[model samples]
Target: MRAAICDDQPQALEELKKMLLRIPAVKKVHTYSDMNNFWATLKDGAYYDVVFMDIDWKQDETGIDFAGRLQEACPYTKIIYVTAYTLDYVEDVFLNHANLSGLLKKPVNQEQLERNLEKILREQSEAEGKLLIYYQGSHIAIPLQDILFLESRLHKSCIVLKKQEYLCNEKLETLKGQLDGRFLNCHKSYMVNMSYIREFRGREILLEENHVIPVSKARAKEAKERFFEYMSARM
Candidate 1:
């Protein structure tokens, strides 16, 4: 992941940069002692996946204020606050901004940094709703929430996403395991993502895009029970 870091202290900036470089997931990192330079680089179309910003500094605008502007420029960029101040002093302001990924205390160790980075990256991936699926010679990340259902076609699997059907080599059981609680095995040959369910007509389930899937007689009772439970949790 491409990253950017800004801290007024030169030693702190170097330490943070060294720690980030050790992380295998971090592809590139840009460090700045001046917030203006950092902001200017981002504004010039420099792409960064994550940014480690220090909140407390003797600057005109604090990191919290800069974060708000960063959100306006790149809403998808993840901002992790590295602050010496207590969260009590920052939480109120931090809560106002979206895409606030993590809050780390000063003198952070390698373990703490790794743990926070793992959580932030995982949450970022999930928030994007992408699911990794591998096919014959290639792999792809399909948006889980956008998938309507999966159908078993002979020896191939058909993923009903949006209004498109893509073929996969995996079976129904494999797909079910890869998916989260949002998908239900409504039939022996079909699995439906609950988020796309529009209605249930007897043994047939209506999904988004006017798609219909069958609910086996034996599984009908269990399906309804589970679906109701899912809806209840959402409510």
Candidate 2:
């Protein structure tokens, strides 16, 4: 996860950065002493999953006000206010924003930081339902729902989406193990996300892209049953 720390005090900023770096899941950490620089970078398209903000900015604008503006630019970004002030002073503002992850008191201990971070990471993983794959020497994490199906071409796997295709080095079997129950192995060469399935024609499955994937004769009955079960639960 990518994170940013915005604190006027340099000691507080580095302390938070050091703590965040210890977490294995954290990919990058950026710090900003000035809110203007932070906003400028975000406006220019910098992305951070979680932002640790100090409530007291020493300026006219408060962190709560800046967080509201941050929401407009990055609605998906989660905000965690690290402040010395009691929650009573900011509880009302915190409750108003659904994107705000949590509030940490000053002199945050390892336990408090890890607990909040674990929550954010777990929520992030579950919300994204990402499937990590390597293609063309680049690592890609695609949302599971975005993928329609996987088609085996020779020894490689071609990931089929609505408008694009990604060639992956992993085989169908390897990819199948990584996916959750939302995906089904319809054929030896085809593994599809049941959520994208539009219609199951005994011998094939029709997806959102109008792409047809063959259904193996052996698994046809089982596939049909599972599809209906999934639809019923979804409805």
Candidate 3:
């Protein structure tokens, strides 16, 4: 996930950075201690999966006010008010924004943050909709429905169907956004289409077509669990 954080205190910003780094899914995070820079980026059509902002950020504009404008500028961005204030006061203001995800308290640790982060990303994935992938000098509409999973070679990621594969220039992360639902990343280089999976071995999955995808060391645990759950539900 690409994220932008707006907090006045440099220390607090750094703390949040450390916690975000622990989560494997949060790929890049940009820090903006100044509200002006935040506004400027929004005007330039900057896209971020999440925004962690201090509600009482000591700038000319309150974070809530800035969030209101954000609703129109980048509707896909999920805003989380990480202030030390009660959410009751600004409930309606944040709700006015297009995609306000949640409000988190300060002094957040890894566990507390992860629970909130999980819920928000789950919704974000569903709300942002399926992403677009272009291939063969033409734009092919690969709905989240048609995909069973995707695997990457050095230069290209192959979109796997039951009987066909489409080659594209997108990276794993780019394809992840385009692929909807629990198309979990079971390998650093392999993102599975949960629908096609039939069963799991120690580190591989049996697809409906008997295709085997090797789950990398990094993502093996999560991948196995995800594949197990998916198969169990079907059985």
Candidate 4:
């Protein structure tokens, strides 16, 4: 796992970096005393699985504010707030929109850091499984969680994501076999990811970003049942 530490205090940043380096799962640890440098690196396409952020900063933009931007830029990257002002910012952190994983009060305890890392690692393991497909003469691995749905485009299959689509040289049935329980075949031509389902209304399933997929009469009952089952398991 690639990790990053964003704290204004040089000492605090170094301490956390040292602790993260000790963890066997963490392959790289990047420390930044300035949020600009961190954001610059992120804009340069640097990906970190988790970022330890300090709530307080000397600049006008607080860590929580920066984290919100980070969330928009990289929705999958987990954000863990490491702050000395935990009591003051705990409510704010929850209220703000971000991919929050865990919160740690500073001076960060090694045990607490490990606990957060363990949980994040477990989630990453579950989501890291990708669907390898041959597209445009290249084998591309798409993260399972990012896939919103699959559409049968005649002989070809369209892998739908939040903002992009990939046409794979395979049938929908063949792709369905590779997917896990989170996917529900709502229609003969459509397999919707239950995680992206916003609501199941009548003969249509509404997904995130207001995309709608049809639910065939034959598969309607089973699709609804599977959707509920998936939601219940997550709860």
lDDT per residue (tens digit) for residues 1-235 in model 2: 8899999999999999999999898889999999889988876557787999888888898788888887666555789888888565477565667377888898978788889989988876675677666676555778888888989998778988888899876656656645788988889899899998888876989898788999999999999998889889999
- Model 2 residue pairs with clashes: none
Preferred candidate (TM-score higher): 1 or 2: 2
Q: What would the TM-score be for candidate 1 when compared with the true structure?
A: 0.53
Estimate the TM-score for candidate 4.
Answer: 0.58
lDDT of candidate 4 vs native? 0.85
**In candidate 1, how many Å is residue 60 off?**
2.4
Task: Give the runs in model 4 whose Cα sits over 4 Å from its true position.
Answer: 131-235
Report the C-alpha lDDT of model 4 over 165-201, residue by residue, as the tens digit. 9997566765664588788888889888899999989
What lDDT is obtained when candidate 3 is compared to the true structure?
0.73
How does each model score on TM-score?
A: 0.53, 0.57, 0.53, 0.58
List the candidates ranked by lDDT, beginning with the highest.
Answer: 4, 2, 1, 3
lDDT of each: 0.79, 0.82, 0.73, 0.85
Q: Which 10 residues in a row give candidate 1 its minimum summed lDDT?
A: 169-178
- Quote the RMSD, in angstroms, for model 4: 14.2
List, residue by residue over 60-90, the lDDT tens digit for candidate 3.
Answer: 7777877877754554467887777655546
Candidate 3 residue-pair clash tally: 3
